[model samples]
Each structure stands twice: as structure tokens, then as C-alpha cells.
Target: MYALIVIISIIFFISCLLFLDYQLGKRNHIKNLRFLDFEPTTGDYNLYTNGDQLFTDLFDDLRHAKKQINVMFFIVKDDDISHELLELLKKKAQEGLRVRLMVDRIGSFRINKATVKQLEQAGIEFTFSSTPKFPFLYYRIQRRNHRKITIIDDEIGYVGGFNMGQEYLGRDAELGNWRDYHLRLIGDVVKDLQITFFDDWYLNTGESYDHIPEPTSEGSKEVEITSTDGGQLEDVFMTLIQQAQDEIFIGTPYFIPSERLMKALLSAMDRGVDVKVIVPMKADHLFVKEAGLPYLSRVRKAGGEVYFFDLGFYHAKVIIIDQELCDIGTANFDRRSLFLNKEVNTLIFNKRFVMDLRLAYLRDVQDSQPFDDHYTQLFNLGTKIRIGLAYLVRPLL
Candidate 1:
């Protein structure tokens, strides 16, 4: 019995040591791979706000994809737009073009098995990222691919907030006029997008291409693609907040923020930077919105402005700083996006592009209402309790 107790104690001690090591490693991981980890290269970027026009451009580009097509999305519903895109992929596959599609299991949970099989039969390769492992269900739920990426022949790419749902194209009655931002990318940065897709693809399907096609230099817009497979995105954002000079504008559907991010935002405001955050008036997820309120409340108290988008379900994950730096991609302003989900964002350091994005944000602001102390009174006791509960599981959200 004494020997048994000693053996168990030794195992417990070793486990504790390993846990401490993991915590320490995770804390320092961002330091090891800072903003400079991903080098900025010259690229041409176009900001697309109209969902109709964005999809039109995407379909047109995909129709012309001669060599290969790669797409990764968090949500790929069985709606008209999704089916249309799938048919296009099928056509490309039948034309001897290598077409690959990946969707997150949870995000695309509603996607029919019949559609997947049809795509497979049509020669289009498809896979689900972070599919559930029965015994490890919690683990599966925590890590998901939330990136919306499409790369064509390794030259052209698209990355941003719009998923494959018809509502994303502004068609839903409940969430009318879906407002979002997607980027049409060309040049050196496209290679990075392709590599990020390749990483998720290989993890899901155990397949990889021979080489990442050599990036062609097209324009002089300097950009860097930062990605986190459940890791460093929040750290990068914190760094960006810390470095902001004059003004910061952030637009996202959900607004839950980490403590570190909250502190950074308050600190930026304290330093005299004009900080404004825009979120959707009609939130798709109430629990998430409620959980975000306390943070927004704190931001308001610190002299930062929080606006509720009144026009539509504003689903844009973007940030513009001092009209000099701009970032847009799949990540949201929530804990799920920061540390739990596989996400990507492109940071562009071009005054011209930043000015365009800033203009777009201002247009959104016109359609939003200031969320002040009065908005806080709208949350009843039950909602406040739910928000408290949601906050506890935020890291796992």
C-alpha cells in the first residue's frame, strides 16, 4: 500500500511539473514569434464592401481558375450561394483543375452530407477541420478553423469575414443587409494565404502539394499575413493597440475581448488615442453579445466610444489605425477568434489603402447608434446572469 501511494504521488508530481511548463510556454509563446515573425511583402489589395459585388468578383475569378483552387471557410451552408460556389468548384474539378474545399465542422454543421458526397463524386476534394473525436469532444469544440480563404492558382486570394451562407450576401430577412468586408489580394501576400490554407488542409487530409508556387511581385502595397492556429493573434492585436498613435477604429460582429486586450484598449484611450468600436445591433448570438457588454462598458468608461450598427448585422473584422495601418480578415473581436480558433488577418501598411478602409468604416458609423449607459440598462437581471455564465466559458467559446 505504501509503494502504491509513492507511485501515485510521483505521477501526480510529474503531471504538475508538466502543467506548469505548459502554462509558462504558452505565456511566452507570443514573445518568441512577434509581429516581425511574418515579414511584410509588397501586394495589391482591394477592399470589397458590397456582398453582391464581392461574390460576383469571386465567382468570376474562380471561373477563370486554370491551374488550382483552394478554399477554406468557417461556415459553408447549404444555401443558394454556397451551392452556386460548390457547382463552380465541381465544374473546375471536372475541367482538370485541382479544387480543394475545407470547412470547420462546427461552423458548417448544417451542411448536408449529400452535398459533400456530390462534391466528392464530382472530383472536388473536401474535408472538415476539427471534426469531433468522440472521446475528446471538448478538445474538438475548443479548436476550430474560422478562416475564410480562397486561393486560385497561388496567384490570387480572398480572405475576410464573409462565409458561405446566403445571409452573408445580405439576403436573410431576420438579419437584413449583411454588411461585411472581404479582400481581393494579389502579389506576394497571396503565397502566405495559400500556405495557411495548406497547413489546415494537410492537418485535416494528410495531403500537401510539392511546392508553394513562387510569389509574383505585382504592386508596391506592403502587407503581412498573420495567422494563428489557436495561438498568437490576440498578442499581435495587443501589440497593434499599444503602437497606435492617433485614432483606432474596429468593426466586428461580436465584441468580447480578453482582459489583456481590454487593458490595452483602455491604455490606448488613456494615452489620448481616439478609440471607437462598432458591433452589430442585431447580434446573431445573444450569449456572445451579452458576454461582451461588460468589456464595452469598461471601454466606454475609459472614454472609448462603442457603437451598435443599426443598418444590419455588421460582420466585418477590421481595424484601421491613424489612416496609416489597416487589417482585415476572418478573426472576430472575441476570445474564440483570438486563442481558440484557427484564424488569419492581413495587415496592410499603405496610406492609400488605409484611407479607403477608413472611409468605409465611417460609412458604417453613419448607420450605427452610440451604445452608452442607456444601452446598459436594457440588459435585464436574467441576461446579466447569463452574461456572467458566458464569461466563464469564454476561453472555450
Candidate 2:
């Protein structure tokens, strides 16, 4: 009995230490935060809503590259579209142009060895970011490089949620229509994206390339690029929610938010701020979709509203506040994106741009099916069991 008591005491002590560490870590991140320094340069941003147009524009820009091409994606499937892109990179590399591509290993597990060999034989530099080895495989598995960025000649860049897949083009009949958001930017913002690609490329392959092109004063649109490798992103979301005055509109495919974000959203709703969230009706992961129901229920209980996109899989990560600020990027509302993955998001402070984004959000809302009390009653007993199981393994999802 004495030994049992001693073991229990040790376990309790360890739990206390862990809880303190978690709290202190968050506080440390918040204490070190500083106001973002916005770039004084201007840029032109073209938003692409459909994947067909997005990929077309991306490939066209790649074909026109004169100097070099830097590309990174979370998923690169072994399909016709992937082959087409691979061939384009090969042709560019063969033409004596620098071409480097990085894809997350786990996300692109289906990419066969023959494709990689082809890339190597053609002088195209291809590498996988955050591949797991023998040791610490579990630890490495959770930290994914989720950013999708393409820098063409250091003058033009693209960033958004669209990945390289046939489904992204709405070709998968099961998944149906694929709706997403991507931005093609030309100006100083390109330099910021280039820096992010450089850092990731060098870390993965030990290859170093540094180039920052001169920014052309094209249009007056203020934006800031925020990149996070498993730190401070939660604080960014919390800050944005706190600063919101009138309303906050968030659209993300995933809904497993951190505790602080959940509290902030609930508080905002309690204060009578219009807070609405749009999530995909059919998510890519079953566990994530099941796990998110509770959070949606909590938000709804707090007077906030939730909508599920019925038209297609809404994979865009966007947030707009009071029709004044807009955030669009690769980050999701899940803990993995906020505290584990390498994500990039751009915060735009231009009212006109925000207005356009607001219009887009309105369109999405029109297409979405709002979740009400009736929706909760539709969940059967088996689904509720699955949801409980999903919540138990939420961290991994």
C-alpha cells in the first residue's frame, strides 16, 4: 500500500509539472510577441476560387519562368496532373533553369519511386520535407510541412490552400466539386514568400539560394506574411478574435481549434459579436469531421452559428473581421496547423480587398447549409459513438 501511494504521488507530481509547462510555454510566446511590421510596398492580388483556373494559372506562370522555379506542396499525387507538372519541371530543368520542388512525404505517400527517379534523371531537384526515419518516427510524423507556395523567378508567387491532386480539380466524383482559394501576388509580398521557400528548401536539402527582387509599386494593397513552425500561430488567432469589433467570419475545412481559440470565439459570441463559421460538409478525414461536432455545438450554444458547405469540400482557410481585415493562407483551425505544422498566412489590411473577400464569403454562406438544433438531432447513436472516439484521438487528427 505504501509503494502504491508513492507511485500515485509521483504520477500526480508529473502531471502538475506538465500542466505548468504548457501554461508557461504559451505565456512565453505571448510575452515575446510584437506588433506586425507591415511592408510599405504595394502588390496586385488575383484570387482564384476554382482549382481548374488555379492550376492553369500556376502552370502558365511556371511555363513562363525565365530564371528559376521554387515550389512546395503538402500533397502531390501520382496522377495525370502530377505527371504533367513533373514533365513541366523536367523540361524547365533541362532548359538550364533552376527547378526545385518539395513535397511532404506522408501526404504524398502514393508518389512512386519511378516518378522520383524521373525527376532526378531530368536534373530536377526534388526532395521530401519531414520524412520519418527509424528513430523518433512518431515525433517527426506529427510535424508536417503544410505550406503550399510557388515562387517563379522571385518576381511572382502563389499561396493558398490548393494542393496538387485530381480531386482539387473536381475530377473525383465521390468528393464532388472542390472549392478552394488561392492568391497570385506580384510585388513585395513575393519576396516574403520567397524567403519562406528558401528557408524550407535549405532546411530540407541543405541547398541555399537567396534573391529578393525589387518591388514595383503596382497597387495599394497592404499585406503581411506570417509564417510559423509550431509556435505563436494560436496567439495570432486569439489576437485577431480579440480585436474584432462587429463580426468575424471564418471558413476552414477543419474545426479542431485550440482551447484558447474556443474560449475566444465563445466570448466574442457572448458579447453579441456576430461570429459565424463555415466548415466542409464532407471533410477529407473522417476522424476530424467527427471530432469537430462538439466544438460546433459549443459555439452554437454560445449564440454563434455554424454552416457546412453543401456545394463541395470547402478547403479554404480564410478569416475576415468587420469587413476591414482579411486572412487567407494554408493554416487550418486544427491544433496541428496552429501548433505543429509549418504554415504561412497573409493578413491583408486593405478595405477594398476585404470587401471583395466578404462578397466571396457571402456567396459561400449562400451555398452552405446552416447547422441548427435540428441538425444535432439527426446524429444517430453510432455516429455519436464515433464522435466520442474521434475526440479521444483528436490530437493525432
Give one digit per residue, the lDDT tens place, for model 2 in 328-375. 999999988887688888888899889999999989999999899788
Runs in model 2 lying further than 4 Å from the true structure: 1-41, 215-219
Poorest stretch of ten by lDDT in candidate 1: 28-37
If candidate 2 were superposed on the true structure by all CA atoms, what would the RMSD be? 5.0
Clashes of 2: 0
lDDT of 1 by residue, 60-133 (tens): 99999889999998998878898899999999999999899999998999877888899999999999997866
Q: What is the lDDT of residue 11 in candidate 1?
A: 100
Report residue 150 deviation for candidate 2 (angstroms): 0.3
Where does candidate 2 clash, by residue pair?
Answer: none
